[model samples]
Target: GADVVHAHGLHAAARTALALSGRSVPLVMTWHTRRYAEGARRQILHLLERRAVRAAAVVLAPSSDLVDRARLRGARDARLAPAAAPSPRSSQAPHEGKVRAELGAVERPLLVAVGSLVPHHGFGTLLDAARVWRALDPVPLVVVAGEGRDRSALQQRIRDEELPVRLVGSRDDAGELIAAADLAVLPSRWEGRSLLAQEALRLGVPLVATEVGGVPELVGEAAELVPFGNGEALARAVVRLLGDPERCAWLAEAGREQAAGWPTEDDTIAHVLSVYDELAQPSPHPR
Candidate 1:
């Protein structure tokens, strides 16, 4: 009954007690993007974004680059309010052997990714990577999780590529695969936050992600970052990591270290409380 709103993400909106209509109140908006265009309009969207932030009580962004971008857009006072990273301990990472058996992965090196099967996620690029991996003596099996409107198109692509990929469909057990897989990949066009990538890192798993959005800010050295939408680069990273267990182990440990900073539910709650407190503080009369 007594609280102020703290908004997060592109669709979030916060309503605070501060008023301009002294009745309309001020908003605290959290911008979660850095290097992506906003609308279909071929115009000054970035500048428009700053004007929107200027109307807010406080401008909070998940990454420093986002803050800088917001400033560049012309927000006089934008700050970083990073998202809470989830802890690996609470993650339901399943036993690799059990999951492998369940998924019939004993015969192949499983290269898997779990996310919305859309153009932005680069399902096509993943297919290309699989093609490269298959050129080797023993090919890797690609299993994809997630369901989207583009399923039919992607299936056609698989047929065209003649790749050994099985669409596992929307899954509730991605944690099992994340633990079982020989490789975890996130080939995306954009990501203000990659919770999928975070899950892999939490399980002390290695990742092959493209350099995009706020992912680099989150993963640090935990992942092998390649250029966006580059099939060759994606395949190279996947093959290199899959071929070398010693390097994979190093990457796994590095992921664990980076994942150590992941914020849990507790952190989210505390941050909300802090924002409410900040909003509730009475404003001093201007001289």
Candidate 2:
């Protein structure tokens, strides 16, 4: 029999709770991200999320924002447990010239945004900002990495509006692409210690991100932040950063310093194992 059951995400927690009904095993749940749905579907998920959090002996979340969310959802014991970024695949240098040439951004300010092309990821907002970037001295090239259901709609809009943006679908070398760009943009509506942000910072690339969820806490003063869904603000921030070489250099150094403070994979494992050990201890008062 299992001593403790650990579940990740809302659906997994719900399923685990149902399976462990009337059992004595303690449930530990890790809340990752909020499910973005609308109307009845959103309501159903809210109820399920509440039930799952309430059932868990302890809930773990990657950021303080998520920990607060879990507590508000009825989790009795919620704690911050940030997930570590995966180590780089190889030490090989990023092909900056090759990536710039392929994207047709050889003489332009190359901007990169990487994530699933979904509504909540805010690709639409980035496209709107791209429209603003069009009036710059040398039009910037915006390339997005990743594919999703919104690809068709986004592509259609890009073609019709003639926005200087390209949806590059999915790429295995997203990190390399990020490193090659002049600026990395994260226009997410919400995020929890974003992996793209981590990777960008770790690579010493300057970043412009939406100030939502755990982003402010994660990047601190290292990256420029704009309000979520504000295309104009995002565009302005990007323009300001690009025009100031000194500021950009400072931000690059700051980004590297910030990333160095994040928890390592081994640290994450040790923290998780400690939680398990604490919960697995025998009861002091036997009934």
lDDT of 1: 0.75
TM-score of each: 0.85, 0.98
The most accurate candidate by lDDT is 2
Clashes of each: 3, 0
**Cα RMSD, model 1:** 3.3
Please give the TM-score that candidate 1 achieves against the real structure. Answer: 0.85
Candidate 1's displacement at residue 111, Å, is 1.3
Q: For model 1, what is the alpha-carbon lDDT of residue 123?
A: 86
23-119 per-residue lDDT for model 2 (tens digits): 9899999999866779999899889989999999999998898898889988999999968877977778657999789889999899999999899
The weakest ten consecutive residues by lDDT in model 1 span: 12-21
